[model samples]
Target: MNIDSITNGVVIDHITAGAGMRLYELLGLGELDCSVAIIKNVQSAKMGKKDIIKIDALIPIDFDVIGYVDPGATVNIIRDEKLVEKRTIDMPELLTGVIKCKNPRCITSVEQELDHVFRLTDRAGKVYRCIYCETKAG
Candidate 1:
């Protein structure tokens, strides 16, 4: 195993490799004006397989969008080669514009002009339903 060191950046760990690009697209990382190091298919002690994203700048997190999609992920803020903050995200019940409804027939999915909208069922339940088509997330 080869672990390269980053001088300064935030490292997102334990992301699913398949979701890596989707994560980037959803987070608007590619559009951002910053150097980003995206590492996928890394060996992990806990996850067995994992992906990591290193951003060479501080980006304020949209926690509501993050928690719902990447609960298994962790964000480690780096400063001068040291980890400044380690944030473990919990599942969020409510979200807006982060994910499209999986159901093809859902209005949000069908209508490119409309933004995806979700309603929180129970904060504790972490359950959300789409507003346009009323598709429940299981």
Candidate 2:
């Protein structure tokens, strides 16, 4: 509960409860050599309970992954212990490399060099379909 404020870093907020670890893994935060904090089930007036991730370093992050995982999440850039920018994550219209095509007949299955791509076809249903095979992503 005594997480220190970062001098310069990114704060991922409003994550759905129990999703902090998945985001951490998906973002490859474990590979970084900087202070990273994952706070889960924190009280939130709007969301009841939410998760937050604070990285104590200014590093590049894949916003697509964040959008896919938690579209409502917010990214706050901190510099000199002050918030410099705030970005609201929204579901990306196109996704590449964030998820893999599971269809066995898909080209990506055989072509190891091919990037698994998907397009948001139904925003209301949060549905995505593979661009190559048209197979719906789970």
Q: Positional deviation of 96 in candidate 1, in angstroms?
A: 1.4
Q: Pick the candidate with the highest TM-score.
A: 2
Task: Provide the lDDT at 90 for model 2.
Answer: 87
TM-score of 1: 0.75
**Clash counts for all predictions:** 0, 0
Question: What is the C-alpha local distance difference test score of each model?
Answer: 0.76, 0.93
Candidate 1 global CA lDDT score:
0.76
TM-scores of the candidates are 0.75, 0.95
Can you tell me which runs of candidate 1 are displaced by over 4 Å? 1-4, 101-115, 120-127, 136-138
lDDT of 1 by residue, 1-138 (tens): 445666677788888666566677778888778788777888888888888887877787676655776777898988888998899987765677777788888866667888787887766666788887778764
- What is the per-residue lDDT of model 2 for residues 40-105, given as tens digits with 9 covering 90 to 100? 999999999999999999999899989888898999999999999999988999999878889999
| Cα misplacement distance, residue 29 of candidate 1 (Å) | 0.3
